[model samples]
Target: MSKYLLNKFLFTVDRDPELVERYRAEPRATVEWWESARANRILGCHADESSTWLCFEDAEREALAAHDYPRLFELGAHPFLTLTLFIAMFERDHPPLGFQTEYARRLAHVRLPYPDIAT
Candidate 1:
């Protein structure tokens, strides 16, 4: 389920540059954007509110920084989406300090075969 959510986010952002811009400009607006996408059938993901809107929070950064994949994944964060969030953070000139390291840490921990991750 979480994997699918992450895929949806990636897909949405890949196709919608404005959404990425919005994410870069307003990180907190992610939930609103996701809701709009789901409502409009733009996001081809399940419409469950429980584990879908976990992208707007500072703890997300801390979780990644600490390599606490369980906490992040349990909170509905797809590993790839976490990477995408990092990219958006940087691309929008809002790079989180040590975000690259955190991303590398997560990538190193990835043991599954996800298309987004080269590993």
Candidate 2:
């Protein structure tokens, strides 16, 4: 596991309990990112029991480190496609800028999980 992404968060939108079930009842949408350097694929995503579950490769909790995590976390949220940029940038045990203190404050909620990527 990448130290930068120790948390594995699986997002489920459970606004409408029936929505989740309905989403799962039919075919799911497949999404891919063009910016991805490797195979970053979202097999399927749909709602069930008031929740929309996204089935992804490995970005479930890894996305928590996203600088955009907060932005992507608002209600009525949808899954994102930025793992390509993340996997392409992170190095083991380092955030590129190292252990930054200021970013922690100014960008606390908007910090990129891997500063090595788009800092």
Candidate 3:
């Protein structure tokens, strides 16, 4: 079982179904979705190099850097923590930090796209 309460990725985003719709509308969405878990992506493809990335759930940086263990209690340091932090950062003014991929065969150098849609 997970140590922290993960706000289910799919359900949380499902509150806005357009996200999935937009993903489908996109030219390509390279993901190995775990359908059993409501399309939770097990492995995501890096848009740049097609590198495979493990998916993390509900992890964050400030929640960690502050040594805020209590808040981080919910953000487990699993191999997949990289992807989870992205969710916790949703709608935040700043982009995600403290996320890293461990075993991507083809690592890609991705930069933050300006004019964030969430803003």
Q: List the residue pairs that clash in candidate 1.
A: none
Model 2 per-residue lDDT tens digits across residues 1-119 = 22211211222212334433332332122012211211222325332222233233344232332434333332112223223222222322356654233324443555334233220
TM-scores, in order shown? 0.44, 0.18, 0.18
lDDT of 1 at 3: 41
Task: State, as a TM-score between 0 and 1, how close model 3 is to the true structure.
Answer: 0.18
Which candidate leads the pack in TM-score?
Answer: 1
| Each candidate: RMSD | 8.0, 15.2, 15.9
Question: What TM value does model 2 have?
Answer: 0.18
Give candidate 2 regions above 4 Å deviation: 1-67, 74-106, 109-119
Better of 1 and 2 by TM-score: 1
Candidate 1 Cα outliers beyond 4 Å, as residue runs = 1-3, 39-71, 74-76, 91-98, 104-119
lDDT by residue (tens digit), candidate 3, 27-94: 12312232223333333433344324333332443433232323433344332432444333332433
lDDT of 1 at 67: 35
Which is the leading candidate under lDDT?
1
Candidate 3 local lDDT, residue 45: 38
